[model samples]
Target: MKQSDQAVVFGKRKEPHTIIIARGSEIRHFTVRPWMAAFAGSAFAALAIGYLLATSYLVLRDDLIGAATARQARMQQAYEDRISALRSQVDRITSRQLLDQQLMETKVSELIERQSQLTKRHGRLGPLLDRAEAVVNGAKPAEGSAPAKPETRVELPSPAADTQLAYAAVGSAKNPFALWSTRNSAAQADSSADHADKLFVTLNQSLRTIESEQLARIDSLAENAYQTADVISDALESAGLPVDADFGKADVGGPLIAVDNPSMFDTKVKELDEALDKLDKVKKEAQRLPLANPAPGRSISSTFGVRRDPLLGTPALHSGMDFRAPMGSDARATAAGIVVKAGWNGGYGRMVEVDHGSGFSTRYAHLSRIDVREGQKIATGDTIGEVGTSGRSTGPHLHYEVRRNGEAVDPLRFLKLGKKVGQYL
Candidate 1:
């Protein structure tokens, strides 16, 4: 061992002072005091404790990191779920609002269409009213007078007013979900929706009322027309004429359409018009028939049918009725026709026979003098002759006869029919 590697003790109280170390042929020595040794030992111990603490921290690092990561993921997931729920709520509110807006638009469109139909109906009603007035008055319209045209004026809501109402009915503002937004916005949306609902309800009710009234008016007009047509038809039948060419043969089949459709109202109006037209035709035809009395304001001296003949004093068929009148009283043609005969006959002296068409003819007999000539066109109530007791008459009277297909029938039935028709006129 080298000298430097030797141990030495030199403390005053014989304490340890030096230490030696050797390796192969080399040697080293260190001198230490008690305080130095103590300090070194403390430093070594502190280093060892620091190493142990570092090893423990390295072993637990993965678990600590995993715990922290998992906690963070949970918090993030919670935040995401809350956000999704809020977004879903907002989306639902938006969808509901949009649906409500669409519904309001649909209702508005329906109401507008109904209003248009009502306007058209009102226009058509004008001509119908005129016809009704003519029917009630019982006077033929003047010749060449044009029928009154239907009024075409109609009032409607202005576009701007409709827009304003629509806007009010639907919420005029857009709703957005934002972090800074408040719950008050949701309340506002609810309020607006309620308001729109109420507005639509009121509008629907009003439309229904208008529709009901129009339908009632149309029905009344139809009923009146039907009644008039029936009366005229009955009169024509009683006058020994076919009622009407198409009286009971109206084509009435088609697809079933909704009553609210415009075509429905138009159809009703058309039906009323047709009925009125039939009545008018029947009136004209009845006028052409021999339904009027030849002598007015005169008492019936003799009735038609089998009666005792005054001249022969025996039961015989009376083909005509006798209306007693003063001398030279005007005897009129019962209907518009062409005079077929205006001369004396075997039993009917100074007679005028009129062909009223439709296989009907009228004879005004026992006339003192004939006013109409053969082939002369004459109208109803035209002075055809003068009443006088000629040929087969008992006194100053007019003999009226109605014939169908050249067969003499009772004239009293036609007279009664004429009186009934006159009441209608």
Candidate 2:
């Protein structure tokens, strides 16, 4: 053994390895350094480890692929579930918005209906209000004039409501009465609903107020007209005459509104119309009757009822009032009527007998000349003859006689009644 072999044997030094080969008496020897031997060993070990690793990968490939695919599927399913939840939330929000929009439209429709109802009520009361105004102004319709058309300066409850209603109905670009509408957000829709509720309450209150006022006005007018009519009718009844036997119908015409079920307003309006009609008829009849003096401001030489006959100088029936007048004084008809007698008679010269309607008649006697012929229409305050002492009269005097149903009554009573109620007529 050499000293280097002894050091390697004692593990104190590195050494190279040797290889020797002999074939058919031929010998060869080669030496490998320590670094080359170590490298060869390390290469062998690396190749073996690589082979083992390759075998392991081939055996477990399917399982790894399955696990990876499952993990990916779980992640995909989780994402899909999240997307579905979000979609459902969106759908819910959209549905809520749609419902709110529908509700808003319905509210607008209700508002329109209420407005139409109020308009109808106002229109129905318009004519009655006009009539009341006429009475207030102390104006009367002509005897044969057409009924006046209804006119008013009154306005509706709210113009803003009308504009909003129009916008809702047709989605009008421009608001006719006031500001236009704008729907921007959910918050705005909610606020608009609340505002509509408040507006509804306010409109209802306004309608109630208008209804009450209209009814009150109608009642007042009806009461006044009826009172006047009643007074005139009482006066006619006190004086023997037909109240409305042949003169109740007036030549008045207008649009007559008919209703299926009448409200209080309608009832009051009808009452007011009836009262005005009654008043008109009463006035016409009163004017037609002999309620005026034949000669105004004249001293009555004799009165109706029993009186001494001036020509006979004996007790005789004198059935007329005598008004003292100078010769050639005007003798007028006391009421409107058709002349029945306009020629001289035996007791009365140049007499004019007028047949007023409703079984009433009047006579103008002691006239020299007759201006009205028989069958001629004469009005009150129209000249019928000239006063003179032509027949059975002591001097120039007028004889005015008022007869009801051919029976003479007191003319002084009618004259006094006329003085009391002429202004009303």
Candidate 3:
């Protein structure tokens, strides 16, 4: 091959090149080899490519940043929405819980009120029962009658039962949010709500039980009062005394005024209270009635009715029954009354007349000594005089008379009635 051709095809040596620039009167020249020129071209190409890449990057920077920022904003919005949903759920749960709590509180208040009324009723009945027990068990003997025998008393429940019932009925509901601190979710809220509902149901059932027990107790008391009142009324009728008009069924009034709004249990309690009040009134009236024998441990010497008078020795109407008693034996008042007459009378000496209420009065005649004065208050079994023979009396004895509106009735009737009443006094 030719040398030139060979050099061109496979050059092993560098070739020189020159560049010349002329401007006005100045000239510059640069010489370079073929290899150096090629290197310079390669460097220029690399710089051009780098510049293009730098410019393209600068132009697209804002779009890239904008796209990234939009993506981040969308993600943040989605997170905020999720948080708002959770907050809404919490709010709903809280509102429902508040409503439930309010309802429970209202129910608790009602139960407490019922318990208070029941307790008050029990308090009133307790004393009345005690009084009845005393009356039935500690009865004093009637004058000129055998002593009363001791009786067994029915046992009553302890007062602590009432206190326990009050505590249970007034108990507060458990906290509905008790488990809120441990977990916060719809499931947790639902669980808490269910627990509250169950608690309220249990509390309501307890209140109902308490109310039932109270009603039963009240009914028992009312029954006892009714029975006692019936007995007292019969005794009063036998003694020829008028029973109180208020005790009649027609005179029964409405329920008592309540401290709060009335309920069925309250109405029942009020009725029981009214019955007890009537029974107590009857008891007091019975105490005031003349139903006791005037002379104790004595036998009737002269019976009331038509009989031979000891002084006259002829058929005469006996105004009173004469009790055979030792001289100077105590003569007690037959009833609680105010003494209206004392000292001597036409046919009797050292007599005492007691005016019981309700147009009833009693007289003790032929007494050796008068212990009671006029206008003096005396109770049953109070010493009013001393038995002796005086005036028209033939022996040491007491003449006792029961008068209704100043008219003498058979004294034996009252003495018999006294004997019957003394058994329950």
How much lDDT does each candidate structure score? 0.73, 0.73, 0.73
| 286: Cα error in model 2, Å | 4.3
lDDT of 2 by residue, 1-425 (tens): 69888878787655456788888799987898878889999999999999999999999999999999999999999999999986775565456545555654565666666567667867876776776555434533333433333322445666466646444433321222121124434465445546655665665576566656656666666666766666667667776555775554457865334465436566667878887887777877788889877887788999887767787778888889999998888988888999999898887877999998888999999898888889999888899888898777889999999998999998999998877666566
**lDDT for residue 55 in candidate 3, whole number 0-100:** 97
TM-score of each: 0.55, 0.56, 0.57
**Model 3, range 1-425, lDDT digits (tens) per residue?**
69989889987785466788899899998887778978989999999999998998899999889999999999999999999997887677666666766775676566566556556756765675565455444444344544433332333334455345434432332443433445666586666556656755765576566656655666656655656667768667755565785567584655355455446556665676666776778778877777787887888888888998777789999988999999999999989999999989978877899999888899999999998799999888999989988888778999999898899898788777767766545
Model 2: lDDT to the true structure: 0.73
TM-score of 1: 0.55
User: What is the Å distance of residue 298 in model 2 from its true position?
Assistant: 4.0
What is candidate 1's CA lDDT for residue 337? Answer: 96
lDDT of 3: 0.73
What is candidate 1's lDDT per residue for 1-425, written digit by digit as tens? Answer: 55444444332346567888998898988888889989999999999999998998899989889999999999999999999987877787767666666776776676666566656666777778678657644532222332322222224344455555655665543333321145436667777668877887776676566556555565555555556556667656756566567766668854334566646667766776776776677677777777777888889988889998788899999998889899999999888999999998988988899999888899988899888899999998899989988887678889889999999988887777777766445
Scored by TM-score, the top model is 3
